[model samples]
Target: MAFGQGNGLQRQVISTLDNQGRDVMGLDTLAWKYPDSSIVSGSLLTVESNHFCVLKSRGAVLDVYETGQHQIITPDKPILGNIVQGFFGGNSPWQYEAIYVQRSKLLAQNKGIATSKEMAIMEYTVDYYVHVDTKDDAVKLITHMPFAGERIPMAELTAYAGPVIEQAINQIVQVTPMEQINERIHDIIELAKGHLSEFLDIYGVHLNDVKVLIMPQDARMRELISLRAFGMSELEAVRMYLALKMADMGLVSAPNAAAGTPFQIGSSTLGTFDVGATAGLPK
Candidate 1:
């Protein structure tokens, strides 16, 4: 091809990537429609920083470019687009799609209610961030993202992530007791990260980090656990709780037991509380 002819096609067929247009940063667009569906060989393809351009022919990823200008070619194109245009009398433009994708790290928040193996219900929240792992992963992400223009909304990424988070919570809660759920949340977070990374990896998405947030359905269950941790038996904890409630109700007076008095079931003081020196009694 003559240099002047190449320049004419370059100038008339493709324009320099303009940052002032739809390709600007911080857009929610996941996939963008390349202006020209019929791409001629040697047309300039520009991809800005933190972005990648994917070329697809007949629904197969043809080429992937990152943060640079690239040219579309016929011989090197994948799928049915690889056919030499020389057969058609001259170099011909091929029908293809060039989609731009964001490569910046993205944050996703998800929530679900998990039912434990013991039938305990727990509400859990998960937050994580991800970015394209490689050229292969970027194409995989586009399967769900499609193109709004030039940016893929983080919401769509996270929306698909919700189910993954929910499944992780279910796996963790199934074996954990309600009373221990709070304490196990950290471990559950790690486990959730494992599940998410494994699942997203299929689409070439890599997990950067994960955080698990949980609120036990029963706060009272947690309180009872704390009381038991203090060396109080379950039955003792119950009685102590009852005594405190009754005292607050003014239904019983504070303990003033005699010296050396054995603890009585009817006493107003808890069995664990110190009764102190017997009042009005001989030493």
Candidate 2:
């Protein structure tokens, strides 16, 4: 909290967030409002080591306090040892907005992503750790990151970054089948990491680490894999795939479909298949 004297009134120039006398936690950014748009000439500003404060007025960043405490006083000669000057104008008061941006690594997670339309309802999860990649990006992140209570939900952050993640995954899945994608999950994740790193460059965040934690969803792909595991030939696999896909497309009616006649088992005007050969064969 910063104490300032403005218009003969002493006010605490602190953030509404975490102002209830509780230890702050899980928040990425917090801000302070000047008392009635007034700032004392010489106020006590307490800044933490891992927190950076930005003072802006008229949409212009005036001074930045990276670390330590300052009296919030502009030096007389613009030379106050190592401190940056130009924050204070005169002995009266200064009006500006102060925002604090967190400088710690944050983890975000999202589960059950279907990369593209071609992908079935497969559940693949992504895990990543992110931090402010640059000072400008830090400012950018602080501006848009949701500020509710004292903390922005890590899940929300994950969702915010989901589009970039899914875009990267979709690029990889566009060329590869689910079989190969599932087999080389780690490699695909590495590709996604690279893509996400580039995609989030505008947001000023670094994808420290990203991975596909679990990849057990493609039902049809899994079925194909199971058939292969059971020593089925490639020709049989293709035939089975066609049959299943046809039924799935509704061209071949399901078991509950009405039959034309009593002896007509799966008798359709479209065509009749020799189910005898495709039935239980030599194992």
Candidate 3:
């Protein structure tokens, strides 16, 4: 909406304006666009510090403004003049888009699940930082990425990058043995970051850092890992496993009465063991 301000001597028409929201530090909004197409000839454009305001029309950049209030003027360049609609005298609307791009790094995190080489379900938490490096990079971002609505939020970028990270993790984890996953955490992170960086580079986003944490979700998997880590005797480990299975099947109950059957433990289907067949024990 265009509005008037100032005294009767001189009036100003602000076709569209940023509300100082983008200037605040630690905000999730990375970029914003002026929504109204009724831009006046001499409208005011406020570009905050650490930001760039770009004027684009028909997928072409007309002019770039940085960190100040710029008065709208039709580009005098021959190529741009052919694309941008002329600004008529007085308060007339012009057909051009004003986009503000913030130059700041952003952090995003996501949780996902993938199967390991041993078929154990593993939960993964990934934290990553990303940013658009320069004004040209920001322009490439706006050009390549799908911009919806008036502003771009941090969640959208995370959502776009989440699948790529997941695919990379799955590829790495699928080949890694379950017992070695803990020791290879650093390698997994580096590998996933490398894969994600290559994919995001085309869109002009830099992956600053990526951290990956993975844990087994299966109780049986945990027990096997403990046995391997602590170097427990084979007989002792077998006895302990048998005792746990007896309790799980309700053959042995805790010291409380009135219990028909104890709740089964570690009901997760991932990496489950059939005690009767695998342990050579009668059902």
| lDDT scores in order | 0.63, 0.54, 0.65
Cα-lDDT of candidate 1:
0.63
lDDT of 3 by residue, 1-283 (tens): 3223431212233322424422432467667776554444456777666677778876788877776787876533332322333443423233567777767677878788989998989989998888777778778778877776887777777788888888988887988888788788877888889988988787777888788889888777677567657775644454456556556767432211112122244772222223233332222
Sorted by lDDT, highest first, which candidate order results? 3, 1, 2
Q: How do all models score by TM-score?
A: 0.60, 0.57, 0.67
Candidate 2 lDDT by residue in tens digits, 41-150:
45555566656666666567767666676665532223322332343332323445566666667766766556433555456678778776445765665566655553
List residue ranges in candidate 3 displaced over 4 A.
Answer: 1-26, 75-93, 219-283
What's the residue-level lDDT of 89 in candidate 1? 37
The number of residue pairs in model 3 that clash at the backbone is 0
Best by TM-score: 3
User: What's the lDDT of the predicted structure labeled candidate 2?
Assistant: 0.54
Clashing pairs in 3: none
Deviation in Å, model 3, residue 163 alpha carbon: 2.8
| Per-residue accuracy of model 1 over 131-203 as CA lDDT, tens digit each | 7857778888887555545446667667777887887778778888766777788788887898889888876
Candidates ranked, most accurate by TM-score first: 3, 1, 2
The candidate with the higher TM-score, 2 or 3, is 3
